[model samples]
Target: MAPSPSSAAQHRHHSSLPTVSSAVSWLFLSLLFLYVVYYSTILFEPAPTFTTTTTTKTATDCQDISTIESNTTRVLRFDTELRHIAFGIAASSRLWRIRKEYLKLWWRRGETRGAVWLDKEVTTTENENLPDIHLSEDTSKFSYTNPNGDRSAIRISRVVSETLRLGMEDVRWFVMGDDDTIFIVENLVRILSKYDHNQFYYIGMTSESHFQNMLFSYGMAFGGGGFAISYPLAVELERMQDRCLQRYPGYYGSDDRMHACMAELNVPLTKEPGFHQNDVHGNLLGLLVAHPVTPLVSLHHLDVVDPIFPGMPRVQSIKHLLESAKYDSASIIQQSICYDKKREWSILVSYGFAIQIVRGILSPRELESPARTFLNWHKRLDYTAYAFNTRPVTRNPCQKPFVYYMSSTEYDKTREKIIGIYTLHRERYPYCKWKMESPEDIDTIVVLKKEDSSRWTKAPRKDCCRVLPATKNGTLYLWIGNCQTNEVIEL
Candidate 1:
């Protein structure tokens, strides 16, 4: 049958619309493919120039970010001073995703806070290809046969050594950390303030296993898994690179050997609380240096350890935990909502009852049977559960336009209460939605807050029952309800 225009429009609206779910899935697939390709190439490459020579190089060559050098000095300096530093990340083709993920902690587009990322460039040349050699991530045939991770260390060292040679100047200090390691940037600057007392300093987590190298009840950072040094310290460290590499051949899997090189050159090492490569959960607060995330640098054989906030996908989860601790025994700040960890969300259906459910108000009977069935079904049906889940697969949200904008309409001028079961409201409950004409609505229109991760904050201020700006370009679904009548109007 030839459908009516209104019926056809409605059917098209519901059937032909694209969803946020589809976009997110597409992005995840694309990145996964890139990551797979990168790692596969790195696993099976032949050994490089420094690998065959023993005692000529240290095992420090094997670790990623080993190519610390000074060639980037011209490109890094801004405003004629070394205010910003650029990290030249070398993600062996296999581990580029890991590198990308790790680097994201420091850099994200549109965020001009601190530091900048000069777009990543991969090494294309082969092993034994001198300064310009590239590393791949296909670790299918990797081994620990040589205690010194020769080939890997040499590749990483060449890149990092060159980066230091370029990026650093007479700035306060230059930090060298791993992609997996989470650095407390503010704390590092604090430690840098004290560099005058000691110029050529090597800072990192001390190794308890290598306790033989201690001095004055402690030794400086045992390795360079992750650490920092001043400009003079940087220069001094650079001078020892060749001799250190020559003596150890390739310090495969050994980052601290660079520290050992610094120690060999009489560069004094100081043990501070923050500069750590180990999981010091309790000590994170006061420490001057530490890897808050994984790939715990400065210390080897500790990469497999887990972060304190277990299973947390976002940094906010960790911060919330710390905040909960910080206010312990103090005034308790209540979160607006508490979500179930295992199950994503719950729907509570009340059958046309009381307007308010307050401390003394009448309570409505919830549909316990339907709720139970829905939860059980969600648990049992893996595919449906996954589709409904709200966890973000990609870290970069705005980069990939996976999620669509919500439809918004101005509240009726005569209404005493804003009662609507909006899809936006369902996803982001307690979101402040206010009308511009209502003088009393000032409280409802929340001010843009710092660190607020809500998207509704940017919702334009409107007068009449106007549709939100972005919704006009695509499909918009909204569920409006009347509080007094106990009826829902789905649009």
Candidate 2:
């Protein structure tokens, strides 16, 4: 009585198909619900918020015009010297070219009265119109063959005594130098003015070469660079000349013998930064480019240094360059080099007379980084204080923007508590505003802003910046800030 087996099987298969479809639909709906819940939880979570607050601070009015006026007057007073300056030269044919180039300029200056002390008689034809000439044989009995095989020591050692005996009664400073030495007269006058002419001051700087300085007394002023003996000192030296020469008979160099005599007289060397005994031989562009803050007095051994300009004769060109710079010493000292491919430098003459090697060859990233400090120039008068106080922050700027910083040592605590900032390159930015903030106990933050961002980037930045007067043309007035004692800290 049951239906066929095939019909029963077909009915069962149709019923199973409906159950499988319903199960698949439920699984898909469950997965969709979980995905929706996960996404909704993420979307509903709190969003992070960032806030940047801009601080607006008023620029402090700190510049005092009267103080600057007084300082200028002081500088003017320091520039003049009442004493007569006399040049005593140790002459030799070996340095005839130097004599021709340097003496000619000295003659033209008319500020210096000069005389050449020679080992033998030299004619005008051979010596090139050099002023007064005296034979060394006629001067002093001190004579010895130096290990260096040069008679310069004997000539230099005796010249001082001979110059005084020759009736230089009116001469206040007897400057003894070799034929190769070139002196800046104005700078010499300014430097000598610092000391009393009546007192016996041996004003000279030590040798630039470490080896030479070590071999001889580091305290001794190398005579080739030239040294000045005050009238009073010269008188004492004259009295002890023969006696001192006999004492140091084995001494070959004039400087060592002079040192011995000075030691006996209890006259310590009064070192002046301007007098340079340049012993190194190479391109001197680095030396002259970053010249010290102090005035340049003299340059010795010119034959070794390269020419100042390209394609020009060394001696004549250097003399002309010096002559031009002599009139405007400030301009020469404050000179900043930006980009000179021919000269092989990018930015020359930084805060420490440092050279920045930024030729076209360097990448932008390399140029952006801080410059390497080249201390080819001599140590600053106060190396420790200078290094600690005037450390730089950025190297992007070539020339220093702020020339002056208020020194806690200079001003009294009761004096108007304002920091002074002076700018040398005012042509780039006429006005600048600065904000000072101290975060850490040791660090002080200074932010400088000008209307023109492009120009602001050129000015140099330092921790404790150098403070120089705005004497150059187009220089701007000083900027004063109400920075507290707590704000100024050691780096």
Candidate 3:
């Protein structure tokens, strides 16, 4: 079986040559295939990039998916330079759902789609389910009555523009509104669609007797509550920015300024059934969308706390608002702690501050006075009660009489100061507590500072009451004199 070594070596060498050649051929084919694929992909599939092109030549027609067509109607809401976070949350969650229900019924008219729910704020998880939100970033470009007024308003305006670009860029008709606005959405949308596209459509509850008539009367001018505008009107309104800024070379409230701008442009504002303004009876504007719209637009005085209209009982809904917050224990202290009283106070103070700043009594940098800062921060109480990074301003009248807290000695001094102030302005300053219609208006309020249940106790007054000396070690008390109700045990 033995053969020559040279013969065997030659046979092995020949076999190895074919194996190497086959490997080389496979490598060449793979390189050629990859080159072809890379070129093909370059020609067919493009990389992501930005462009200035609009939707004019496209079948979808609009650059943004958010715009409505001529036959469509939208319900929009605006926010100004203020913190109505609690109200916004409440409206978006509770009232919006109500409006959606009405739209479901009213949208049946010839493909007259549902109303557009819009707001001028950065949408969050709390309101992500809400239909359309425009996150605004250029609100600072807009002016407000006071310096801080822009904080809420600018954010809102930025959001509004964003919403428009997103929803109405190619849409024909749309409605603008505030969070607290109330109306019959379905009916309004159906009615608005039956209008002339050539004409401006500004639909809301019109006032016949100017601003004096019950807020929801008939007038031609569009209401800030919820106004529907055609595509032309939307475009025209959007274009009014230059003139609007020029006309008011200073601070301006968004809603009122918008009305003023409309007037200047001579746009014929129209109306539909169920459009409303600031009527709080909750009865005047029957089930649709309700607005907490206007005050959020500009600076609010941080003094007027409490609801204006008695239509809705002042229920403590902060619990609901708080429950809606995400459970991030770390950031709990960083959130706004909104209080019912403080919320009212913020409105009053902001209103006054807005006026002052507009009238040149204050500047933006100095706008954050002790009182102003306190009120601004007070709004956070709604969602962060009993939770804090630092201790809350604890010191008398922690809940009632609307007075600041100081030590017992300081309380007396402050009380005397208040009495003296009231005495001096008694003719002009009326007592707020006695404005109630009845003696039975008293309700018990149990206020808590910490999570301890034992710390909770009944507020001392059984009737409409005011603050008093505490009877317990760490509790406060109140005495409802008009209703002759009084009990005390806690400090």
How many collisions between residues are there in candidate 1? Answer: 71
* Model 2 TM-score (2 dp): 0.56
lDDT of 3: 0.31
Superposed model 1: Cα runs more than 4 Å off: 1-91, 108-150, 158-160, 167-170, 208-225, 250-252, 279-303, 314-491
Over 419-465, each residue of candidate 2 has an lDDT whose tens digit, in order, gives: 21222211342222222211111111111111111110123221122
Best by lDDT: 2
Whichever of 1 and 2 has more TM-score, that candidate is: 2
- Angstrom error of the Cα, residue 258, model 3: value is 1.3
Better of 1 and 2 by lDDT: 2
Worst lDDT run of 10 residues, candidate 3, spans: 351-360
Per-candidate TM vs. native? Answer: 0.37, 0.56, 0.33
| Candidate 3: regions farther than 4 A off | 1-128, 146-161, 167-170, 207-224, 249-252, 280-491
How high is the lDDT of residue 113 in model 3? 26
lDDT of 1 by residue, 130-230 (tens): 12223322323323345634455444443345566555443545555554544433223333443452356666555322222332124545333355665
Model 2 residue runs over 4 Å out of place are 1-72, 75-83, 125-129, 138-152, 334-346, 350-491
* lDDT accuracy of residue 174 in candidate 3: 54
State which candidate has the highest TM-score. Answer: 2
After superposition of all CA atoms, the RMSD between model 1 and the true structure is 32.2
Query: What would the TM-score be for candidate 1 when compared with the true structure?
Result: 0.37
